[model samples]
Target: MVADGIVSAYPVDPEDGPPVGISKDDALTLKALMSPVKGALGYSLEDARQLYLKERIGVGEDPRRHAARNRLAKLFVRAEAGGLPASTLLVDLTRQQARDVRDHMLTYEKPGGGKVAPASVKRDLTIMKAMIGHAIREFDLIKAAHNPFEALEVGISSGGEEDIAARELKETLPDAVIAAMRGNLQGELNLIWGLGSRHARLSH
Candidate 1:
């Protein structure tokens, strides 16, 4: 059956002097044997590889490239995951990616302080998505195409209203979290961010 076909593709020992391949007949037999169990570990392949690498070939693992996510913020995380049990480096990398997406969104405006064009909106979202994707890949997180600013159909410069911008930014998290790169809330979508200095104050 199909089970035997997958098993036949399993890597085997090369030092066994070119051992006989898992024949079609044996494949059928293995298929019948595997029908009951699904996705079973056929053999202890991991231990064998480690042993072979240690005994037959001793090689040092690379350190430079695979060390951190970005060279600029390498110090933010650390060379080795210290305090954190599950790879602190990975967590740090994701945080930095989130920050970048925020910074990109903040500065999205024209030189003359006009509205942000439709082109710019899509571009900024794409850039943010690319960074987010990198983090997702690193830690293996599920991602969706849901837009936090779904109602934001306009492109306007935030620098125009400095005071309101500050207030709106704070209201994003309510805990003074100035770096809310991603948000997914239902009802009362914190319109402070979308409005300028005039709408900065909360309606009584």
Candidate 2:
């Protein structure tokens, strides 16, 4: 959903969950880390990171939140490497700039030089959208018209064909094996089989 073709229907609120310890000193530090002004592109990006930390870290911490923060931090570094100055205004980020970031994520390597999964890249892009949306709708830091991320759609190039192939291979159990399992575990096997079939259908 959207509002006036500007704000998002779902706005992020830091206070929605348990309060976080965003001390005055820390806030000042984050602000200083940003470009002296509030609406600079890097400043808003930093604010988005702060929002994610406040909301996801307030009540408790988990692997998922940790992963999300790390992904965003990595993307920020990539943006800097791509020549976007810390003082770039939020309104100045172009559609091409956003696309460049997506492209970079597509080939991003893991710490051990392993390929990053498409699903992981997709998740990071989704987080980027949410961060930009929150900046626009909740913080009123950037006007929706000036939000470059608003026009972009994140998609894996191969339509997740690799994932489908992996799932198919996993489910191709032999009839004899399936029969033995069903015979040994009648009711449990029935439930499991039904769920597996339902999941396969939904995946299509």
TM-score top scorer: 2
- Residues 1-204, candidate 1: write the lDDT tens digits: 565455657666567732246674555456447542311212121222233334433445555423322321322232122221122222223433343344344444567876445445444444334433444343233331222222333233345433233334554334344235215433455455445323534641
TM-score of each: 0.21, 0.48
Model 2 alpha-carbon miss at residue 32, Å = 19
For model 2, how does the per-residue alpha-carbon lDDT over 1-204 read when each residue is reduced to its tens digit? 112222222343566732245544444444444534542223446665677668643334577767666767776787666554434545456788777776676666678876677667666667667766665565655443356666465555433434233555665657798678667776876899878856866876
Which parts of model 1 have CA positions greater than 4 angstroms off?
1-109, 143-204
lDDT of each model, Cα atoms only?
0.37, 0.59
TM-score, model 1 to reference: 0.21
